[model samples]
Target: MEIADMFSTTTIPFSGITLEQVVLAVIIAVIGLIAVKVIASAFTEMLGRTSRLSALIIELLVRFFSILLYVILVLIVLATLGFDVSSVVLGLSAVIGLILGFGLQDTVTNLASGVWVAAFRPLDKGEYVEVNGISGTVTSVGILATELLKPDNTYITIPNSQVWGSAVINSTRMDTRRLEVKVGVAYDSDLTLAIRVATDLMKNDERVLPSPEPVVVVTELADSSVNLSLRAWTKTADLWGAQWDLNREIVNAFADAGIAIPFPQMDVHLDGTH
Candidate 1:
C-alpha cells in the first residue's frame, strides 16, 4: 500500500483520530507558527522603512498583529482537531469576559494606556528620561510595560498606565539645553572682576552657543560669599561636559584674578571674667 493509504488506515489506540489527520495537524501547526513569524517580521520591516511612524507605533502595530495571527492560528488548530470554530470563539469570548469581570481591569487599563502612549509619544526609544521617579534610557515601549536601562546597567520595567499618567522628563529631546553654573566668591572680592571672569569662561568654551550670549549676574549676597550665576546655552549632548569644564575653569580663573572663595566662619567673644 502507498504511504498515504497506510497513514489514512492507521489509528492510535483508544482514539479515533487517524495518523494522517494527526500528521496533518502537526504540519499545520508548524507552518502556521512560521507563517505568523514571517508575516510579523515582514510587517515590521515595512513599517520600519517608513519615516512617518514613530518606533513606538511600529512596535505596537507589530505586536498587535502578531497576537491576532496567533489567535487565528489557535482557532485553526482547534478546528483541525474536529472542534466547532464558532462554538470555540463564543466560548473564548465568554471566558475573556469572565476573566475581565474577575479583576483584569488593570490589564485593560494598561492596554488602553499603551495605545495612548503610542499616540502621544511623550518619550521615544534611546531617549534619557525620568518617569515615575525612575530615570533611565528608554529601551522599548510594549503593550503592558515600558522598559528602560538605567545608567548603572540596571533594567527597569514600568507599567504603561504609570508611564502615561506621570510626567515624563526627556533630557535629550531638545537640541540644546541651558547650563547654569553657580560660584560663590568672598563678599569683599571685586564683584565686577568675578563676573567678567565667569562670563569669559562661558564665552570661551566652544560648546556654548553665542546667539543668546552668556550672562553672569550677582544672584545673591550670602553671609559667607557672593553668589554669581553663570548661564549659557549649549547643545544637549555637550551640556554635562561644558558644565564640568566651566566649573573647573571658574575656580582657576577666580584664583588667578585674585578673587577669594571664602569658607564659612564665625567670630566668638568671651568676657574677661571668664
Candidate 2:
C-alpha cells in the first residue's frame, strides 16, 4: 500500500482521530514552538535597546511573555485536537492552585516586591545608597535580593521586601556635592582678610566648582576665636579629596598671614595684700 493510502485508511483505536490529522497536529506544534523561540529572541533583543530598563526587569519581561505565548499556543493546539478549552484550563488551574497553596506565600511576596523594585528603580547598581539602615554601593539587584558592596569590601545581601519597604537614599545620583569645613582664627585677626584668603584658595583649586562660587564667612564669635565657615562645591568623585586638601591649604595660609587658631585657654589674675 502507498503511504498516502495507508494514512487515509489508518484510524486511531476507538476514536475519530485519523493518522493524517495526527501528523498535521505534530507539524503545527513544531511550527508553533519554533515561532515561540524566534519571537522570544526578538523580544529580548528589543528590550536590550532600552538603556533605562534594568536586567531584573528584562528577565521578568522575557519570562512573562514566553509563558503567555506558550499558554496561547497550548490552547490553540488543544482546540485543534477537538478538546474542550475550558475544561483543560480549569484542570490546569486546579493543579497550579494546589502548588501555590503549598507554602508559596513568601516566594510570591518576594517576587512581587522584586517586580516593584525593577519597575520603580529606587536605586541602580554602582550607586551609593543607604537602605534599611545599611549603607553601601549597590552591586546587583536580583529578583529576590539586592547585593551591596560595603566600604570595607564586604558584600551584604538584603531581601527585596526589606529594601523596598525601607527608605532609600541615593547619594551618588547628584552631579556635585557640597562640603563645609570650619576653622577658627584668633579673635584679633582680620576677619575680612581671612575670608579673602580662604576664597582665593577655593577658587584656585581645580576640583572646586566655580558656578556657585565658594563661600567664606564668619559663622560664630566665641570667647577666644572667630569660627570661619568655608562652604565649597565639587564633583561627587572629588568631594572628599577636595575637602581634605582645602582644609590643609586654609590652615597653612592662616599661619603664613599671622592668623592664630588658638586652643581653649583662660587667664587667671590674683592680687595679694600684705
RMSD in order of candidates: 2.1, 7.5
Model 1 pairs in collision: none
Q: What C-alpha lDDT values do all the predictions have? A: 0.92, 0.86
Query: For candidate 1, lDDT tens digit of each residue in 148-207?
Result: 999999999999999999999999999999999998999789989889888888888999
TM-score of 1: 0.91
Candidate 1, position 266, lDDT: 66
Candidate 2 TM-score, C-alpha based: 0.63
Report the Cα lDDT for residue 179, model 2. Answer: 81
> Cα deviation of 273 in candidate 2 (Å)?
12
Tell me each candidate's TM-score. 0.91, 0.63
Error of 1 at 41 (Å): 2.4
The 10-residue segment of model 1 with minimum total lDDT is 12-21
Q: What's model 1's overall lDDT?
A: 0.92
Top TM-score hit: 1
